[model samples]
Target chain A: MTAMRPDLERTASALFAGAPDWTAIAESGLPRLLVPEAAGGFGGDWGDAEAVLRLAGAAALAQPLAEAMLAARLLADAGVALPAGRVTIAIAQGRVTDGRFTGSAPAVPWGGASDAVLAAVGGELLLLPPGVATPGLSPAGEPRDRLDWQGAAVLAAGRASTSLGKSGVGDSAASEPDLLALAGWARAAQVAGALGAALDLAVDHVNTRVQFGKPLARQQAVQQQLAVLASEVAAAGMASAAAAAALDAGGDCRLALAAAKLRANLAIGRGVAIAHQVHGAIGFTRDYPLQLLTRRLMGWRSEFGSEGAWADRLGALAVARGSAGLWATITG
Target chain B: MVAVFALPPFAFPDDSAALRGDIRAFLARHQPASEPAARANCWAVADPEFSRALGAAGFIGMTWPEAYGGRARSAMARYIILEELLAAGAPVGAHWIADRQTGPLLLRYGSEAQRRRWLPGMAAGEVFACIGLSEPGAGSDLAGVRSRAERVAGGWRLNGQKLWTSGAHHAQVMLALLRSEAGSERQAGLSQFLIPLDTPGITIRPVIDLVGNHDFNEVFFDDVIVPEDALVGVEGDGWRQVTAELAIERSGPERYLSSHALLAALIDSAPQDPAVVRVIGELVAELWTLRQMSMATAAKLAGGEDPVVEAAIVKDLGNSFEQRLPQAIQAVLAADLDGATPLLRCLARLLLVSPSFSLRGGTREVLRGIIARGMGLR
Candidate 1:
């Protein structure tokens, strides 16, 4: 299915274009859009949500939209009752020792602002209330808290749903969600969006800012750099779209998500450098909106899984499959 | 705001997998006896025998009309065959230019007579073609070509020198672009001529590459005459035709699969090395991503949409990935070996030939310039 929801994308852009309002996002019913209508929520598919998430990223909307959408899907998949208000998800290395959750989750997105936290443990999903752990912030000043589950009471806990295999939409009666893959998918979309924004800013800047009595865009070197940036953005966008489509098709999207994140991270590495170079002094300043998008790119790329980490995971999978099986692993 | 640069999601048709299996079986039976180091040449190595065998199996020009000896398959089917051939390092280079661009170009722009004369031979792998775009005076700046053709009584007389003409010596036909009007503006008076290489007053000399390969050549045409039928498309439409041809040239598996044999070798030889595995995984991931992009572009082209910007983006990034692959592998395998293994030997060959990856199709700067212009920056 095509991921072009022009109406939803326009609404998302208008709402998140400047300073993001979590209350507005929640009020717009966008956060729970992925939750099935049978579960008392809007029944939008992953393709629809992909549009909103990508626009949210392009507009540099600093809210918990992606986290909330992912958390709602995970909770629905685990058969947990949907929570009111904003929700965030975190994968923590903890255990249910003595009927109480005890572990630490570092860099939980919107951990402080979220009303509830869905912590994914080994083969289980734990719902933790807010203020149950110490909060932290990401490099971009987003609410990425360090979650300590020691002595925190779990409101609900259940075994995560195994893959439902390939089934059509509204057939969620069998499939379970993979929290990490969902989160990685969300981050990939955001990175793609941010790259898009950075590319736009760089292009605009190069075309307007004059150097040597002509627009910087006239310089072959500058044009080359911008072109490279655009290519990376295009590639990242494609990778992210592929992953979203895979998830939408009810397939195990771990491979797609891994590649998406890897490619997105690589895009961020080159995209941000060229963007900043194009904008020069203004891009480095706080006044320009370029930093808002570029900063998120830097922060979001390292979240869920860094490039090296995902590369390691993907590489391990490839090695396990061996040379003979490599092509099938990719195309299958 | 820029319409979100994206390749719409796409996959091969249902029958492609079976077709892929058939190709794999064919490859298993007909693999060359070359070592992995030689196979590392990938799609760049020319082998007419292998090409003929592939054509015998009905793999070449599968997308053309059946009347032209083709199977009239979908573009995705052709894509599958090409990708499989390049991935396995099959020596289809002898027919690559004809199958990929020349045959398609003629099908799109050539007259009925030209198609009837050339299509079946190309589809049967009995004809080879070479592009004559870059001239001695004009490289990336194609508009600066000094090659000129003058109108004669029944045809045109051509005079020009083409540089870096791959397979020119081996090709039966040359799709040469020449400026036919002396005072016309840039990109205005160019026209394509389908010249037979055996025409009188044409000379081809080898331009040995860094790796000592004889694939590239320089061809000079002095007062060469061709019939009026040699003109492709309407006069003065060569710029548009060549531009369209490049989209086919740039957005193919050949752009990125040049180092695939090395990659396969690396995966086979160092499956346990963590550093090597990580790099290989990253490469594989990138490769998959690029293929998806290229496939999406192919789908768009099949749908009659001109994805010029998208094709340029793929070629630029694909070239960068391939050109840097050897260095990345060298970093991971930090051992001073004297071609002790096939992996090392492949690595050496890739290192020598990698520089040409960006130079071919289009240089990085030229591609990026096209991309920037597409993004409205220029």
Candidate 2:
């Protein structure tokens, strides 16, 4: 089955293409889309979330759509009530002493705008009310607010609290969702969408913008560059889609997520370069709209985990399997 | 915005696990212990006995109809076996083209009598075939074929030279693509013929590659005559017929799995270096991703959609992975080339042979162009 529902896809395209508002996204019931039907929410899977996150990325949306949906699912898994306002989950490590969080979630997406940040500190998954969020920003200038809830009272804790798969909160019926990898997966989907947007811009640029008496696309040199760019875009899309399916199937979560994130992170370099290069100085302008995609592509590569970080994780897994098990590991 | 290379959700058949186990068992029992480097370029390693044994076991032609001596299995079923054989580095060179494209082409386009005559032998692995698409004059610009076939009395006379005809020395027949109508050009009036290799005035000369291997050859036809039934499909439909199976041709496990043996060897070497581990890990990640792309392409093809662009994406990406793998390994670990170990030898073998990964099926540039055209860049 396709991950994207037709109606949701059409709405997302229109909504993101224009000004994407959190109210519209939450009002459209996107944050609750992954919650089980028994729990007062849509019983959709990660595949659906994958498509939404991709659209959010394509538009380089400033709204915390990925974070909000993930927080809802994390709450659902913990058997907690869905929050009314926008929310995000802290994927970074923090410590809770005397029912107070002392560590800061350095890069909580839109923490100031979110109603609360669901966090797991020292074996307890707690929802911390927003308290004096220190504003930070991603390379795209989107909100990457720092949440430091010093001596803050816990809003709630889940029925079943366990360490989140990444560094911190959630479990599923089949497989536990690694919050860190989940965040990375969200960015990977975003990277894929951003790459697609960049490729489209580059393709359109080459076909229309005349250079040296012909469209840039007419030159073999330019065509070759675009070909490379297209290959990267296709690869990122494949990797993202594959990981989404793997998570849906309850397959190897860590391996699939690592590969997907790495693939997308690696692709951003060539993809962003070719997209901007074809437009020359015109693309470099603030009004060009190409930077909207290229900037996210540049920042998203290091968002969840940089290429090198994921590569290290994969390498350790590979070495643990050893050479004899390499084939089985790959095929399995 | 477009799903140009969008891979659909796919799962292997429920019985594929058992099917894979059986093939693994068969391979373990029958696979001869050949050279370590041989398995790296295993698909080009011709072993007729191994091929015949595999055929007898029903691995060959598993997807064709039972009436044509096939096992009547699904395409995904056959894909499982094909991948198993490739991953294990079995000598599959002999029946690869015949089982993969030529036999399928004949089944779809050849006459009933032609199918009855040729398919059973091919399914049995007793018959081997090579493609005659590329000639001296037609490499990447495949439409510039100079091969000519004339309608001589009672039959057609073929006169042309086919280049890069892999396994021509062992093939029983050549699925030759030639211009049937006089003075036709650029993919027009082209026709395919099932010309027997032993026909009169035919010569097969080996073309040793840089690695000094005899896997490839040049086949010359001097007025070779074949009966009327030899023509596959209607005249002037050869281009369409050939292009029809390209997605399937480029969508197999052979594209990326070729370099698998080398990765296995590296793991076996047991280098504890983190850099080495990282390289191997990166390769595995890339391989895993490529396989997903391939499976998606396969699913699309099985669903009866012609995923030519998707298949090209797989091939170009897969080939680059294959070509980069050896170099990636070499870059991370300093292999003692002079007193080389097994891993180093496999690296060398792959470094020499992996160049053909892109060259085979279609060049990387050509595949990318197909992807570009599919994206409306052309």
Pairs that clash in candidate 2 = A164-A168, A164-A169, A323-B267
| DockQ score, prediction 2 | 0.59
Number of the predicted model whose lDDT against the real structure is largest? 1
Tell me the lDDT of candidate 2: 0.80
Q: Write the per-residue lDDT of candidate 1 for residues B1-378, one digit (tens) a residue.
A: 665356687876566789999999999989854577777756778888888888989999999999888889988888888888888888887899999999999899999899989989888888999999998778988888778889999999999899999999779999998998877867999999999999999999999988789989999999999998999998999999998898778888788888888888777664677898889878977998998888888898888988888888888889889878888989989777589888888899899898889999888888887787887776
Q: All candidates' TM-scores?
A: 0.95, 0.94
Q: Which pairs, if any, clash in model 1?
A: A136-A145
Error of 1 at A124 (Å): 3.1
| DockQ (CA atoms), all models | 0.64, 0.59
TM-score for chain B of all predictions:
0.97, 0.98
Compute the lDDT of residue B209 as modeled in candidate 2. 95
Misplaced by over 4 Å in model 2 are A1-4, A120-126, A149-177, A323-332, B32-35
Worst 10 residues of 1 chain B by lDDT: B1-10
Number of clashes in every candidate structure? 1, 3
